[model samples]
Target: MGTTQLESVPEPKYWHLKTVLSEALDSEFSVGEILPNERELAARFGVARATLRQALEQLELEGRLQRRRGVGTTVAPPRMGVAVGTEQRVWPGVGEDAWQAVGCTLAAPPAAVAAALETPREQSVHIVRRSRVSHGQPVAAELLYVPQTSAPELSAIDASSEAARARVVLRELHRLELQGQDSAVELGSARADDARQLDRLPGAPVLVVTTRYFAEGRTAALSVATYRADTCRLTFGASGVEILHGQERQAS
Candidate 1:
């Protein structure tokens, strides 16, 4: 790294340093390369250690750097592309292999989800938990809400375990004639549960994709998937496959 003293600018010093560090990452660093320690970097940039720390945090938030446990800060790989929506609309878990069923339970969903599902706020629904992994790293977590009215045939004898219940809920969803689906994406902070599933800190940046499945002329199910922002990039397209970090690959 060069000892390029930054000139005074209107932006905060840490912000300016973050921009410079980002450029250095692009030109001088490779993915997974550990950056110099705080003392060395602060001296190199002629900035206070506090300023350097702030800049590093910013870079990490922007998905440019990663601070591994017991390993120093390193350049993060390009975000893996996660297919949020494709032309062929299918129910969650139908023809999908990327996500694994975690568990399922009956509970009252959040108010927003209840509103979206057009269910009574006090009504309990089947909440299915799922996780998605890429490159052997957890990348996303999901909660699929199914109203009782939507899966009237689910029985306790058929779904003996939590995972089994999740599968049965999905099976019931598949029985519905999937009329159409719509999705919306936005930046969000990871909640405690999602952070644990994705192996990220609470309040870490995340991309939230909310999808609504329409069937029988009503909102039958709702899916809210939270993806790790630092490791996943979302894509929407006609082809079922989505681009990987920097290359085209089949969605898994």
Candidate 2:
């Protein structure tokens, strides 16, 4: 007599596909290696295009992969630590790190930014927007303010010239005797603009890092940086490195 056998159900398509693709990225793929187009991957997996895209979106959000407009999805490297305050408050480029100034603008600050800047609601501040990209993937976006004093020398600079503008800001900031700094990290969602710059949808989860640079006992400069939380683990002070390995969240 032939025995009837119970068939095992295939894993839920999205979860199974994401799991398979994630493991593949960790194993076969090296950081920055571009993957086959999503269409091709979907075909290979025998799943609908939506299902494939869902999985890809998850990977990108988790920083396991990155997707660009003209370019395709590529494996993402680890997030940069960027040494918050190791020895002393050094000026930019003092170390091997490089910070590229994306663009600069003058506008009314957000409520939080205004509060941090200790400026009036009607007062306009020069909001310099900067982005840090490492290993070909965008990592952090920073908003810096000169407060008219931190960069008093900037008036001598030709703002139209990118290098001139960047130099003016850096030159003035470096003049500060490198005093102390205070930083705070809190749960945040990418605002409309941040999400756009970070290449994610509105309301995407992010770690907002606000740091205040003090020199001569006064607030010298202030920076509000947003880091992709899914792909980043924000560390603070001397204890952060030890805390990074505390515990990994278990999959529900």
lDDT of each: 0.85, 0.66
> Given candidate 1, what's the lDDT at residue 212?
91
Expressed as tens digits, the lDDT of each residue in 1-252 for candidate 2 is 111111232755676677778888877888878898867787677778898788877776676776655677778767545434444565553454445677665557777766776767666666666776755656678887656556665554567766457656766778778687777888788898888888766666678878887776667767888887655766544422211222443121
Best by lDDT: 1
Instruction: Give the range where candidate 1 is weakest over 10 consecutive residues by summed lDDT.
Output: 241-250
TM-score of 2: 0.62
Q: Best by TM-score, which number?
A: 1
Global local distance difference test of model 1: 0.85
Residue 102 of model 1, lDDT score: 92
